[model samples]
Target chain A: MFPPRSQRILLAVLAASALLSAVSGRLNPYFLDVALGAGISVVLASSLNLINGFTGQFSLGHAGFMAVGAYASAMLTTTLAPRLGLSANLLQWVFFPLSLVAGGLLAALAGVAVGAPSLRLKGDYLAIVTLGFGEIIKVVLQNVDAVGASRGLTGIPSHTNFFWVFGSAAVTVYVVWALLNSTYGRGFLAVADDEVAAEAMGLNTTGYKITAFVVGAFFAGVAGGLYAHLKGYLNPGGFSFDKSIEIVVMVILGGMGRHSGVVVAALLLTVLTESLRQTGAFRMIVYSVLLIVLMLTRPQGLFVWPLWSKKEGRP
Target chain B: MNRSVSGPRSRRSFLTLAACSAVLAGCREKDGDTGAQAIRLGLFGALSGSEAGLGQYTDMGATLALEEVNAAGGVLGRRLEMVREDNRTMAGESATAVKKLLSRDQVVAVIGDGNSGRCLEAGPLCQAAGVPMVSPAATNPKVTEIGDCIFRVCFTDPFQGAVMARFARETLHLSKVGLLVDASAPYSLGLASVFRERFAAEGGTVVSEQRFSGGDKDFRAQLTALKSAGIEAVFAPSYYHSGGLILRQARDLGFDGPMLGSDGWEAPELLEVAGRTAEGSYFPVHFSPENTDPLVAGFLDRFRRRFGKPPTGVSALAFDTLQLIADALRRAGSAEPPAIRAALASTREFQGITGRISMDSGRNARKPAVIIGVRDGAFRFLRVVDPGDPGRASS
Candidate 1:
């Protein structure tokens, strides 16, 4: 059980994010870019942790939900926001945040569409279904001329600063933490532990799985919206199967079910990537080697054991 | 289950926060010192990803120009310093790279984003900062439309597509053509669409249009579809990797008329992979090393002497782009970005290795496209087709 201090934690996170965003203008732009990248990774990995780590569902289409959110928010902010008759200052606060929320809602809808049928299947079958869904989203985005087709959507006003990115990240962490600690959230653990037994106990395992998928996908969409504004452009290729694998890797490397461990892993991996920029052409080779060594050494997750007290009746 | 209250958990969280700040502090230490009097010029590209060749070639070309300019008393009495960043070929990475070049490195002008997708990501930032960005070979028309500060030395897709269509219709005398487009690439699709419309407008019929994704090795199926459609020539708008295989496969199918392609088909692999079957294939190229122009000869010699390898068309365009920047810098008489942009926009009849270049109203180079014919595993120059007179392609 979590302490009755969720409201205080939320306020602290918001204050810290706003303070960082205020002074971030004076930071080295390269460091700021890398930090923003790390914040986005934390959002993505934590949301994915909800499904794969806590709910025991192997959903591989996080990037698809992300692309849906990115494009939706990109279109809203770029095309629809200009027509809303709001002043520039009002548009920044109103249209931008609303568009991000709209993007998250649309991605949640996509999550329901994917989870309703696929939740019946388990393990590799669910993984395959989600993988196919991700590909389908990419190909559809590639062909839809309304969204610029293969040329990609550009001219998205850059609305994502440190406050927006880290603020969303903090909110994501709080929501996932708060939800998982609630009594109703115990069904997710039961389903993840033993699906048949959870159903035998009348726990409605499918409903729990669907809930995890919807919440995880909503955050992933917000992450995508932040990403589109960060880069000011969206190419379908950017949300390919490779991107999905990246988020999955972060989750697995972070000790899946643990939120704090996932955040550290996301930040470490992001910093590692930016540091390897000095290695020139061999950076990828070195990066893969480091990952292989990490996996070989810390199979249970990098920041798992000894960092937290061992739970009862668990390894 | 005894749930211990959080003592170590808070410590671990504090450690994570400390590690994050340490990383940020370490990044701050890397703020390098540039030469006091050097005019820094930046280039960002996919130097370490699948598209690494584009970046490497651009760097070599730009460095050669930098050497020559510095040797000739430099521009504005200051040596031109080349600062390059690897974008890793991703759009998001490219934005960060461009931002670093602008804010961290403080380069006066940015150059050499060979891929259009990456350039689009970098273009808006450069435009917003009032910094001139001269792309060497990103041929998408939308690149320059970002703003007046964005310029490209290479011809756009529409120009090359129109040139190939005219060549197929007038020179090759082909009325019915079949198209094999690479659907995965925007370049291929853009070129294919333009060629389709222009060929039709030229009174030539597009008999069949088939699609294949990039990295698909076999094209016999699409070639068969086109061959059976009773087409006189095959128009495969793709890069040299698949372009070569398409040519060889069409020949194997005994349907060799004259294969017409765009500038994407200019790599040496087109002749090597297609082998003897590559003969009679024509493609529009930015530069042909076989040209007898003194500018072309001088560029080839200098590039070979420095990089110790023959230059590709991409390198030639990159060489022209950097030289154009240096020319603009000298003409502007100041190293300021806005002045350089103004000077670049006013460029007219500046002879580059590729050809005489002039910046049009759109900040695109208004230059001729060179047509190259393949014969015996070598690229041969055919004619120069100017934009004004598409019909007058004189050798």
Candidate 2:
């Protein structure tokens, strides 16, 4: 197995090279575009795993965070990037990272606000709350006139590249992985395993749960920001309930607690969805069948084993 | 006992090996690339979801165009290849499809994003990457406003709104109008704005304006408000799916007033959805494809032969847009973005199934809008409004 640090560094280098190649027009623009999409999905799926897998929260409002990120990043880049009068090269470097962070921060704030009340609930109630939150975000966004409301925000400078997308995904994975391996991560797992026991253990269960929720939302928001720039447009429809479910599906299918599982699932699912398009009208039916079959055959998911599985009987 | 243990162990190993071989074989077969040399054009639409009919019809239209273009030695001696991607009516998926089309397929251009919101999301990426996109049916002005690289064949909401307004004032001779709009839809909101602005300008009063969401099935509250306002004509600018439900519900609620809408009511399903209530409703469309013009007749004949049904307004617009792109390519003599944009901007008097096509300063098609009224469960052409007489009363 590769060292975690070196694996991350290697991934970063590969992503940087891809971005450079794309901007220089040396790489196939189409492949670069697909890479960017896969990268964004990786960010979304992995972040959502933190809440659904590690914290054992059943939130389905991933798209709400994405919307927050998209709108926030769009407003920042469009409103602030121009005033700064930064050179094109500098703007490319600075605004991309700034938008990602802004998106994450705004999403985190939204997560905290939503999670404060909903986190206290359990099972279907929490799911309903998160689903409702996602719908509310879409509805509120549809009416906010400053960002063009239902008409959507246009004329966003297209600065999202392969590097920006994969780099952010890498950072999200690293952060989430590191957090999962630390005391906070243990607290999250404990809450997931048994909330009552976790609280009995003197752990601030609510605090840990909320932290995971916020962090997960933050990464989702960052992915949304990357998506907005990559598409060069922002619309509420992009962050609808259907989108939230897609991310959740990714996390579940990748095996909730497994990091590489999420990554592989994101890539495989993305490719499968695209390939299924060639099957004409029956594609969706076939996809649904496949999902059902997979569930029945492999209930624990394809990659159920966590990369850093604790030594047997140690816990 | 030892022999028995060896036999069981060998059987287990054999099964595992067979499963591995099966997986490997499946992967290899699926990974094979059937290489074809053609200019791959990506088509994104809600192909397999709630809006499957819309996407299927669009695919048919695009396929017809692609087949015809290829039959004629293709564009620039290369066959036109269509790489279809289903958005499932989700904007995020649409964006992802756009990326895949641009990066993986290396498509020359993209066509047929039926929904306005999806187009709005995907248009910018195309513009940024300098890949020309021609949306056949996305009518919201915001889609093209993204950049110069984006072009749409269909008229914007402003044009359709004016058409509906003219029909209401002149053809229907209704001075008092009620606007029942889907506030959640960019298309509906835009049309409502323009229709209200132009109707009032033409010495008509928008007596009542009621709002509803896209998924709203019941407009009883809004209709009740309109009924109290004593409006003679109702303008409901929304997609046929929702418009049919509203019309059916309104008729059930004793609304007998003439209803007017934009091209969103151009689906055949409208008749089935609204039943007899949809009759007498007027809507403006880009084309009917039922015209007697030889070129249009030829297209309709070919479309019927291929798809076994009459094409809707969207299908015609999509077909025309593809043709327009081909025409522009011929005129520009190159597939480069700047050349094509310049060629597209200078387009004038180009005969399209819709009408004599031209471009205004806003890069919108400057073609005449055709008003079609539902008569006997079929679209009957009422009149065609020219761009010259913007204020000509239909009567």
Candidate 3:
């Protein structure tokens, strides 16, 4: 099922460089813009899928973590890229992905801080907490000086394009999907099924829960970093509860806990939002109407995938 | 406009009017399938959302300008066709909309992004594409700093802040000042920063300062602090919604100081919310309908006939922006983007409905601001200030 390790690395390099070269040409800005948006959505949905779908954390503050990651990454690139004084070519190759990593790691840390307290809560209560946390993040960013306050940090080098977004998306899917297949991944499923039973079975449910949040936070951070660079702009207004709800819709519209389904849903919704530009004033209204129809028809999502290839429900 | 006094009109002017209308009809019909001979322009704004009003007014201004151009036998024998895009008032979304205009619709010159945030977002994209974009009312200084291809027709924040500061210090002749700034708003903060700097530079003392966030209903605490400071006047650079509430609260605390504000106090809600408390408030603005200049009156009548209402400051600036673009196109003698950019940069003493606009090196418009006073439930034009030159503070 797997290619040889050296060959896989060589293929990945070839694909990335090819994408870069293609984008360097007069790639249709219209299609590239919509496709880049779709790629970011894919990352966000899949990351949120980890906590809400696989581990059953049901986070409503995914946008807050995204904001943190975006601001952190934006600050790094805008500040450090200039100070490095390197050639433009070297800067793009070296510092671009480094900022994303920096953003993701910071978001993972934020997950630990917030998840440590609120993980004890369940269901709707947890949702409410996460929602509040999201608003708090926006407010804090607005008041902070380093991030340009409410004006938001502009002049961010527009580095996000097809290669970085799709590559990061691929990495997010592989890491999450691979994690879900490990022995520790079984603990996550057990916790989601029943906490009491999983605890009685000697599973460290709390540890697994935190792991899910950190992992989810990491990819969401990556998504935020890409988003910050894609628009070459960042604003707290873009990361409100509306953003969180939009991501949740993408997750639920696909099958919960289904990675491939989430990717498809993200692509569909992103492209739809862009393609409906011709609808004028009724574009968003039409988007909502279509989504409602989809929900009413296929409530469990378009793709329903079993987590494991087994007949039994749980361990 | 010149009809004969007698029952039988003169034939010469009648023929001219008929020719004008026919040319206008031709311009309006140029959007037909041929698609070859017309110059394509683009317009983008908050076409739908909470701020849709601004976008609608922008469209109206451009529509009027286009009608004038088309009526005058079109531009270089090519009728101007606008490819309008609704930016939806988001930074990334506006960029995407402009990108579509650049790639798909392929507009030569773009105008719009009435607000600063979206202008800042879309400016660099236009620069990269070598398209000229002129913002009608983006007052933020950073909008033009993106590149040479980006420009705006409104006075930047620093100029606006200094205008208000000078008015509060020289025009109103007040020395001791109290400042109230909204910490959460970029406009308010930028305005407050400059007002503070220039107020100090102008040798006026700022006795006390207070801060509040947007949507905070209660301002008694900040008012009490400013009132107790015994300042002569209060400068509250905030939105009308919050400004109205703050005025009410300040009065309840018995601070009768002269309350000054920026264009954020443009809405009518300040009167409804603050009631009689809103009287005597002073603020700097882009346009006032009460001006008696012939240019102002002429445009006012045309705007009324077209949009069914007097143009607000936002719309007036937008109208001037389009006229300014048309002026540049006429001078450049070509539809090329780079040539248009050069022509726009060299514009000086261009008679817009608002005022004469000249471009600075930063691509920001060097223009004067009008400070108006609220008296007897109406806006009274008070004084005009040009902050770039202190000698021309009032003209």
The candidate scoring highest on TM-score is 1
Question: What is the interface RMSD, in angstroms, for predicted model 2?
Answer: 11.5
Q: Of the candidates shown, which would achieve the greatest DockQ relative to the real structure?
A: 1
**Which tens-of-lDDT digit does each residue in B1-395 have in candidate 1?**
11211224473355347446745754755666767799999999877767889888988888888899999999888999987888777658888888878987788899958888788888998999999999999887788889989999988876777788878877778899999999888778878887887788889999999999988999999999999999999999889999999999999999979998887788778888999999999999888888888889989998899989999888999899999999999999999999999999999999999888988888888888899998778889998766453222110
Q: Rank the candidates by lDDT, best first.
A: 1, 3, 2
Docking category of candidate 2:
incorrect
Model 1 docking tier (incorrect/acceptable/medium/high): acceptable
What's the distance in Å from true for residue A57, model 1? 3.2
Give me the displacement of residue A112 in model 2, in angstroms: 2.0
- Please give the fraction of native interface contacts (Cα pairs under 8 Å between A and B) kept by each candidate: 0.33, 0.33, 0.27
The residue pairs that clash in candidate 2, if any, are: A29-B103, A30-B102, A30-B103, A30-B104, A31-B103
Q: Return the candidate ranking by TM-score, descending.
A: 1, 3, 2
Name the lDDT value of residue B189 in candidate 3: 83
Instruction: Give fnat (model 3).
Output: 0.27
Tens-place lDDT per residue, model 2, A134-232, is: 999998988888888876787777788766776777677777777776655678888888999989999988898789889999998999888888777
Q: Which stretches of candidate 1 lie over 4 Å from their true place?
A: A1-3, A26-28, A305-307, A310-315, B1-23, B71-73, B161-260, B264-279, B301-305, B376-379, B389-395
Ranking by DockQ: 1, 2, 3
lDDT of 3 by residue, A192-242 (tens): 878889999999888888899999998889899999998988878788888
Please report, in order, the local distance difference test score of every candidate based on alpha carbons: 0.85, 0.77, 0.80
